[model samples]
Structures are given as C-alpha cells and as structure tokens.
Target: MKMRARCCLIALLIILNWAQQAPATEDVPGVGSLPPEVLKLLQDLNRQYGPDTVTLVSWLLDAATHSGSVLTASVRVTGNEAREDGTFLVFQIETGLIFNTRVFDQSGRLTVLWSKILAQAFAHLDTLQIPADGVMIDLLYHHKAFAETDDLSEHVDEPGSVEEAKFYFPGDPLRAFLGKKLSSPALLARTQVFINDTPVPYGAIRTETANGSH
Candidate 1:
C-alpha cells in the first residue's frame, strides 16, 4: 500500500509539471497576437508598473527612408482599458530634428501613461546606433478611472471621441533635449503645431523659450 501511494504522488507531480509547461488554452484578448519580442517588452513594462497598466497596441520600424542613416518609427499605445474604449496615442519619430504626435481619444476619460515605457523603447532603439538629430515625444496624463479591468470584452463597441495634434521641432537638437527634464507646454511652444494635419499659423500658438532650450 505504501509503494502504491508513493507512485500516485509521483504521477501527480509529473502531471503538474506538464501543466505548468503547457501553453494557455486560449489567447489573451488584446495582446495575444503581438510578436514575441513585443509581448516580452510589454510583460516587462507591466511587471514594473503594476499589472495591466499599459498595453502596446502596435509598433512599426523602418530604416529604408534615409539610406539607413535614419530610423523612422511609429508606436501606438493605450491604457489598460479596452482598445476600442480608450484613447490611442500615436507617435511618429523620424529623421532630423522633427517628429510628429497625434492623439485619438475614443473616450474623453481615457488617458495614456507611458513615460517609462517610451524611455525604454528609445533606449532599445539606441542600441542600433541610429543618429539622433532630434527627438519628438508626446506626453500626456492618465486618469485614475483608466485603470485595468479583468473583463475587456464588456467595454468593446463603446462610443468614444477623437482628437489629434502634431508638433514639429527644427534643427539638430536631440542632444540638448535629452540633457534636461521635459516639459510639454514649453516644448509645444517651441514647435509648429498642426491640428488634424493642418498647420497652425505662426503666432497662433504661443511660443516660449524652453528652459535649456536647444
């Protein structure tokens, strides 16, 4: 009887090991289709910022634009809310001192919290030795109401709104911009703005010399 009980326990352990190594029976709703590298990065971010605080919706990288001297990329991110129920913050990082940002807020209450993740993304890109003539970043605050939910399916199909603004920086100011703390208003003042792709005429938006302006 003792030998039989020991064999049963050994069999249970083997089953548990197999279960742990097996893949999930169903994919995670929004992030299941992401590339393995991207999924790993998102998992790392979540581990740092509490579970489900940020989700990477999509990312594109292109180096053919400038004979390989420049890397053009776009990234879209959202809060923990359902993708259709929240804002999509889009970033267009390009060559030279210019970059573009657009905000598509599906729900006015939706906000994006991505400072840490963005920094990491840039750091990873830096590994390629891409020239940094300048940098453009979109900064925004997230509402507490945008916290994660266990059931994202319920938020699907919710009606929401959209807003977009683009800012451009001129000259090779990447080094200078990276050396100091970033301020959105100050940076905006120094940039040329476009709403829905229409350029805002000079002086239409107030301009200010950023502290340690590049």
Candidate 2:
C-alpha cells in the first residue's frame, strides 16, 4: 500500500511539471496586419516609453502629394483616470492638445521624431512625479492660441502683437511670406524661436522654397 501511494504522488508531480512546461497560446490579435513602418514605430515607442503609452493614432502611406506618406501618433502625459502602469492617459476633445511633443508628418520619414516625442513624454513623467488622479489642467492654458491658429511651435506667454511684429500673425499665411523672404535652408534651421531656444524639428517647417534643397 505504501509503495502504491508513493508511485501515485510521483505521477502527479510529473503531470504538474508537464503542465508548467506547456507553451502558452498566443492571443495577439490583428497585429500582423499593420504596416511595416507602423509596426517598427510601435515597437520603438514601446521600448522608449513603457508598453501601451504610445498608440498608432493614424497613418497614410500615400498622402497624394510630393510628400510620400504621413504617420501620426500620440504620447500620453497625464489625466484624471489611471492606466495599468498607475498613470493616466488623456486626450482633449475641445483642443487637439494630446501630446507634449508634436511633430508634423511631412515626408513620411519622421519615425525618429516620433520616438523622440515618446522619450520626452516619459522624461516629463519622471520630472513631474504626477499622481494618478492628477489631470492636465494646464494643457489648454499653454496651447490655446496655437490650437486655434494651427501654429506648430509658439509660446503662450508671448504677446499677440509679437505675431504681428514678426509678420507671423495668422500663422499659416505667414509661411509663404517667410518661404519667399527667407529662402535659405541653412538659415531657417539656425533661426531660433524665442520659446526655448529650440529650433523647430526638421520637416516641421517644410516650405516650397526650401523643399528639395534639404
């Protein structure tokens, strides 16, 4: 009887070990259908800013112009709700102030910029130490004018007259003026905006004058 009982226990342990060694069923659905660039960008962003913080907002492989394709993504900063990582991801409905670092998709080759934005977002999270319940109440306050005017990079504190002073009032319309007036790619890249001494990201300020030069 003792020998039979010992054999039964050994058989049960072997079954348990077999169960532990069994391969798990993969349930990743619909990921194989994504574009090569999109998949690559997703993986890059995930590595930069923990998983699920960056999502494929939109993609246009053929934008039907000189520009080849356009890829848009969002990097969540903070919100009232909580994510699985104990952080909140929020998007504004009234204003398009979703991500902290916004890169204009000009030539379909700004995947590097997308990764930079995700990194910046994670850095912001580390610097701020924002709580789970914290909402981004200051997003609109910082981005109100630019959101209304579609300006790429502008500060909130600068006076509206500075826009007129610099001939940048009604932002998009002034691009043509600057394109003609300042037709040097080297100069444009060096020209510093007053905000953070940060020149606009490459491809963010594409102009007809400086189109093929760079």
Q: Taking the tens digit of each residue's C-alpha lDDT, what string does model 2 give over 31-115?
A: 4544556445544433443322332111110111112111121222333444333333332211112222333222221222122
lDDT against the true structure, per candidate, is 0.31, 0.27
* Best-performing candidate as measured by TM-score: 1
lDDT of 1: 0.31
Between which residue pairs do clashes occur in model 2?
Answer: none
Candidate 1's residue-wise lDDT over 35-148, tens digit each? 667555544433343221232111111211221111222332222221232322233432111121223232211112112223223222212111222233333221112224
Error of 1 at 188 (Å): 2.6
Q: TM-scores for all candidates?
A: 0.29, 0.20
lDDT of 1 at 94: 26
* Alpha-carbon runs more than 4 Å astray in model 1: 1-90, 93-156, 181-186, 200-214
